[model samples]
Target chain A: MKELSRRGLLGLGGALGAAALLSACGEASGSASSDSLSTPAKLRVWFMKDSVSDKAQAWLKQEFENKFQGSTLTIEQQEWDGIVPKLQTALASPESTPDIIELGNTQAPTFCAVGALADLSGMKEELGGANLTKSLVELGSFENKMYAAPFYAGSRIVFYRKDMFQKLGLAIPKTIDELTAVATKIQTGNPEKNAHFSGMFLPGISSQSAFAWVFSNGGRLAVQKDGKWEGGLSSPESQKAIAQLQQLWTTGSTTGTITDSTIGSQPYTAFNTGEAGMFFGFNFHLKKIKKELLDAGKVGYFNFPSPKGDAVGNPFAGGSNVAISNNSKARGLAKEALKLIFSKPFQEFFATEGGWVPGNLNYAAALGQDELSKVTIEAVRNSVGTPAAKNWALVESAKVVDDFFVAMGALKDPVGLAKTADAKMTEILNSK
Target chain B: MTVTSTRAKPEGTLPDRTEPAAPRKRRRNPLPYILLLPAVLIVLVDMGYPLLRQITMAFQHFSLEQQFGKPAEFVGLDNFTRVLGDSAFWLTLGRSLAFCLVCAALTMAIGIGGALLLTKLSRPVSVFVQAAMLLAWAMPVLSSLQVFQWIFDSRSGVVDWTLAGLGMQGMAGYNWFSNPLTFFAVAAILVIWMSVPLVVFMVYASVTQIDESMLEASTLDGANGWKQFREITVPTIAPVLLLVTILEIIWDLRVFTQIFILQKNGGITEQTNVLGTYVYQVGLSGGDYGVASATALIMLLITLLLTWRYVTQFLKQGEV
Candidate 1:
């Protein structure tokens, strides 16, 4: 038995040595001529699942293959929830990295700062020049060099049951306080008539929606003060906003425990059932409501109300940016693909099919003559975004804001929770 | 006596043994070693390299910069120190232990009961029961977890609706994943449901192999079923029980998918983290592979300590 075991160990050692030698040889060969794309190349593009329209994907695939002559572009769809880790590891490896990649506007800074994307500053004029989404441009640029170009933009709007509002004798709220009163009346009256009714389905886990309240009230989640980041949740403006949000949670909400993220992705799911009277969601969410609800003209969108009752409230802007991988072997082909992506025909698809505000405003003419589009454009114009800190994505990933709001929903001490959450946010945002 | 002598005769060993001519080279048999090569190579590559990498990562500052082709600095015990100093790591460790113990105990108790019941059933019934359990055991974890999520969904879920129909109005729209206790309860029930089948199969196979004559003798000695099971059946199948228990403990300690999946919707992140999910959060989400590796090593040591007794017993049995 001992002899057999010893022989097995010897065999294993031999096999491992051979495997290591083979891999070493492979690496040596790969580095021999690594600077340029070889013939018959395959360009791998990773686009998030719901970010881009299907027509755009099909067009890009056909166009890239047609134009490049010898290259193929494969668009791999990725999910947003856990993609940061996937991107970090994938983009770090030259062999594994995709040729073309899409970055969430919030996540672009991290990649750009790490030098994971090729420089796109030279394409500024060719892409869109000053017509790109300004916030996305800011996010995708590092040290005045653009690493990503704007792809599309979206912002949250209040989607209400217009029919229900008239039934309840409530007018569309014009101010934050009036909105609260409407929500309270609807919620209290909802349960008395319907078993599972909610005034506005503002789930506690939906921190981004809650941030609209904070931003409109002139509150920041975190701010760079004295060359260091300090969490702004404890600021009076933020506290007041959180208190209003807390009031909505206590008086206007139905389910306080489940996260809004779960509902956010499919906001129409609840509203379509006629159980939810109002919902805070992106403009495209209107297209996702049940057919019966749509046919009845029940869904109507409006910009969130300002704190002062004088203007549209600013929301947290959400969007995507496209960039080529720095380590891509087919960077030349990827650039050609990017050019195709930014062309007028393809860019207009963002507004025409995907129902998003085109990153290039020139194509936004295609979005003309629709109430949803009008409200969405107004919401997008009025929206503010997260601080341009490289580590804000980490804070979002850590769920600091999400937890704070969810805790607030449970009627926990808003002051105490905000203080604690602020300290955590400060630790993370400054950890950069 | 004549038959025994004939069977033991030297002539009997030589007859029909043309291979005996190569007896001198028999000790150098290459066939068995050749057969073992594939298995040994698989284990060496699949298990050995990753373990080595994990240990190396545990001792180094392997963060995003290192991940992106920069040189990884080797910092002796820094990762360990950070993990040891963090209160959250300790919380995760405690939660992991508590989850494992509870899940393992429940799995074993139900497993033993099912195995006992199978023994008393008729042959056809036993076959049908075993087949049903095998189906459950065969289902993939991902598919089963999704089904469980649907079953307990806050809205339109069957569990809530049924409970509400039973006059439990509070459960009508009860959000199960929101609460840490309820979330783990759902996870535990799913895990136990998936794990019991294997334990039942193992215990039943061993129980059927128990010496029937010994059981008969015990029965004749006026011992009851419970007493016989304790004194005779348990001792006879004690080795299998030890092995199954050790395996269950190890599996339970590394519970990941159920908790991770539920946490996606639960949003109770801080309160519900276990060791596996905590490591993932730190390594991937936090982008700190160094501390995650250190935590993983600590978990490995805990599992080793837990299974050490049974492992040594297993080795001793092999020796005997």
Candidate 2:
């Protein structure tokens, strides 16, 4: 009986050990060094969803492969939802890291500071040195060394239904207050008598779109004073912006309840469904609007208006930066492919096909001289960017700003929430 | 049963000589040890390594910089101190505990009731119900999450449509994920709905093994159905119940997927965070690995402490 009990105990111990171990598996780490320029190697490139047009991706892949016979270049499209964490893990080891990557311009500083990307300082002149977007260059550089290169730039434009405006005898709003009044008028008018109609599809979770109000009101998300970063959401200018936004949420839109990021990012969806009179979106969302609306000349767009009916408003600059991973085994080959990505044809694709301001300002003329393209260029010219802090990506990941705006949209106590959010932002920004 | 009886006959006859036979049994045998070596080594390499690394990381200042190539400095309980001092950690812990207990209780109650009902149903009906439950259990979590999101969607969802149709005008365009209370309510329902089937299967299997003769005798003695169940069925299935309850508690305490996915749709992420999501947000999203590891270690201890009594009672029963 003693021996039997001891054997049983051994079995039980083994079972428990196995059960506990099943929960976690360590990530494998390995290093490789293969820098031969002539050797044929498969190069993998990662582009964010909706950032690169299919034509651009295909042209780059073909051009690179043609330039280097026997080498294959593959483009993998990744989602933006959790790209930061995914990059953190994937970029840690040589075996798993993609050779080339496209990250949000805002996220470039984080990767650059952490030494996740190869230094591009030597090729700065070769890749458009002075012609690259100025703000993007500032963001992609760390300690005076450039890492990621600006791929493209864009800013939000307000897309409104001309038919609705004509029916309601409304003209294009020229100021922030006038825009709110127009949205409210449309909401109350209910021209189509649709249930759940939003005059402006500005969801609380679309914090990027909401940034237009703050920026146009002379407010910033964060500001550096005496080399110390402080949250700017509680500033008087920002408080005024929040008050105006709250008023819009209360009377101008019913989409304040939308919390899903997917729906928040795609403002054109509600506009296409006829549930919204206007939406703040990128120029590329033009393709997403219904063909019927476009054919009927019902769809129109304009740059975000200023606060006092002055010049154009400064909306958040929306764009991406391309870089080569430091861990790539074929560093030489990756740089060659990156050069192809910035060539005239590939760069023009950004303007012509993707409806974006090309990173190389020289090629932006390919976007044509149409009214829409002119407005898009003007918006991008006046665009503002987030604080160029090293840890700004961490704040984005923590969703502090997004949550603050979401609370305001819900009509919560904005004063208390803004103070709390600012403090959290300060702590994270300063953390080593 | 026949094999045990046959073997016991010889032991019964030689009871006086058992002491002498024990010496022969005590002789060293390497076969069992050799057989266990493969599994033991696999467990150590597979699970033991990660656990050791996590424990070490909990004591060090590890972050994204350290993850790349920087040397991690030993912090020696600094991570623990910071996590414990933070008010957010305490709030998350309290919320996790409340959510876990509520989900486990609801799952168990409904599971047990379903199992009892199955026992009284006709054979075909029981089989149909069991089959339906098997499908629900086998469905992938992501698929179920997609369906549940659709059902509770703020716009064009069946729930709001039905409520509005019933003349609740305000129910139109109601967002379930905007408010924290409704956010958790939806998450709890999803967790319980997915878990109840397993408990039902386990309890039903154990309850069928109960002795029919004892139940018949109690019935003959004019005992009511509830009285017979309390007297006989409870004791017969006590072991299974104890095991199931402990497993449920552990599983629910560390629930991550349902809550994490639902939180993506809800705007109030901080307000709705439980321990699992909190750790993920801090470590993966916040890029602070040290504090996350410390928090996870604390969570593991809490789970073990909560289940210690039941685990000991189970081992004692096994010994008997």
Candidate 3:
């Protein structure tokens, strides 16, 4: 009983202190995070790991110091997976704000929409002006103003096993049917190597890659019907694309029981392991394939064939976008950092070292590094962005997304399944 | 006799001493609670505050915009109504319930069997068994999850190779995560494997505390080993078993890291998702805090309902 009393007093005291601290931290009117200084001398710039490769770090450091003479630019490299939550937490506190950050190109709209990104309309010309890719910029725009600058563009290419294709007596496919035929033949011919081989590694989880399919068939994800966003999944072109993709999953691709990409399997991993005859992945996969295989000669690359004969490869262009934080203490230094990033010298490193096509259109010459570079560059040039809609993120994160793809993988009737999914997608998209 | 007792009071006896001698000088000092104050402070600051904050946030129409200085509008039960109406919330809750119950039952069964086996073994053998269980228990969830993914990997997992060696044609490197059953099986197996050690330890400790005289008495009365265990040993460890069961249920219900990591590894996020992972995906990834928090509170309510009996039993035992 004496022990109980002591424990009770201690618990009460701790609970009181905790409640007080919580209210102090959570209350909007609290001054716990306020700063008296008008300007912060040191600007903290948080970027994802591998965004700036080792080769460009030296040049970037010198440029930042030279550009912003008295101040310092502290670059904190964060991993891709943890950056979102960390950014959210930092954005919630004025004291922990970083001056600049890099967001995934697809995720930029959500951040911009949520008021986490600074308005970059003032520093437009200094960053890139007319030289930036229009589609990439559109992804970062909200309410008729740009919030982010296109940092890099990663385009997909069809990486194939050269020897396997040669053994099957096939040339690089030019049309969607030809590619499907090649994958089928290769998968069927060599049962030993091809039993586990997905003739093509098109993951059900990869909606971006899947979107490219629908778009290449001339279907938009959303159409401006009556001045409001309406989903296009039920359209004839989309149905046609879904039907073809469903057919691929039924006969040409691996069983749903074999591979799932959202579970973390990379298209490149299968291709490198020789378990896939063909794969569609970023051109950045070339380095990984080279490192894994130890010899780059064994692999070959080609453009994703269109349904139209010999038309340009049109992939879903994906990359990171650079943005100044809305809560940033030093916007001037961040702009200076952006100036260096946009320069010819810095942009060239993206291709030669970083394996990304620079967002600047003039840096197209960087594609001379490898044979696959040209195919990927062409795809990026002709690529389409996800529809500029407010509810795109909501639709992407909806439960129906998985069910829709799983149904496709299960070989459901494409038209019926797509129509059902379209209704759900529209519901989520229409949510405020 | 009264006269003789009064004669002894003339010595060094100071009156009748009716004050109870200050509780006979208690052995344990009251200051130990003071020593524990720091740990209590840390837990309240780190864990207790966040939980209370989460509960409060559940009622507000909060968003990323309100994370900084913007005030959250109090919406009463609207968030709960919205979440309870969501089709996905119900689906995920159903999945979580099924997964947790199955995992908890399996773990308890396996743990009890393993504990009984340990008792029958020699000291060295039992120690080695305990050590093995401890090793698995000590392994980090993420690292073991990675191993599990590789073990079930379609292209190169050993499960497929063994299946092929058995003359199964298309069973090699099976993507175990795509199917709901296979995904749950894999998740359950990992959870059970990780949790069995704690249950085993608790059962073993309680079993050892059973009086040897009771076992001997049951045996001498012509009862067999199994009969003695059922009548005497089981009753002796009943409370421990109940405690372990309650804990296992709670742990299984709240499982997040393993499923989340596996989803990240296997790309079957939608199909393989449980309540904890679903909450994170919706709340953090989808930025739908209202729905996530409401779902979480519902999970808490479900847990409370399920464990109410055990809690009452424990409280009754405490009073006794």
Query: Best lDDT goes to which candidate?
Result: 2
* TM-scores for every predicted model: 0.90, 0.94, 0.86
**DockQ score for model 2:** 0.40
The Cα error of candidate 1 at residue A281, in Å, is 1.5
The residue pairs in collision within model 2 are: none
User: Candidate 1 chain B — worst ten consecutive residues by lDDT sum?
Assistant: B1-10
DockQ preference between candidates 1 and 2, better one: 2
**Tens digits of per-residue lDDT for model 2 on A233-343?**
999989999999999999999887789999998999999988999999999999999999999999999989999988999999989899998888898999899888888
Report every candidate's CA lDDT.
0.81, 0.86, 0.72
Tens digits of per-residue lDDT for model 2, B223-282: 998897788887889888887888888788888889888988987889989888888788
Question: What residue pairs are clashing in model 3?
Answer: A262-B267, A263-B265, A263-B266, A263-B267, A264-B267, B160-B173
True contacts kept of each: 0.30, 0.41, 0.26
Per-residue lDDT for A333 in model 3? 61
lDDT of 3 by residue, B1-320 (tens): 44335433543366534446433422233444465688778766765776588678789886555654467788999989988887867788889888989999999999988888888899998999999999999999888888888888766789878898899967766767767788788888899989999989889888888898888887789999889878988877887887778777777887888887666544546667777777776666556565666667677677768776876675556455
lDDT of 2 at A42: 98
Model 3 misplaced stretches (Cα beyond 4 Å): A1-44, A65-86, A95-98, A161-169, A191-198, A255-265, A273-275, A290-300, A369-371, A397-403, B1-44
- DockQ of all models, two decimals each: 0.26, 0.40, 0.23
Across residues B1-320, which tens digit of lDDT does each residue of candidate 1 receive? 45335333444556545666545444355555566689778776765666577778889897665665567789999999999998888988899899999999999999999999999999999999999999999999989988998899888789999999999999987888878899899999999999999999999999999989998988899999999989998888887888788778877887788888888878878888988788777777776777878887787778778777876785566455
Better of 2 and 3 by TM-score: 2
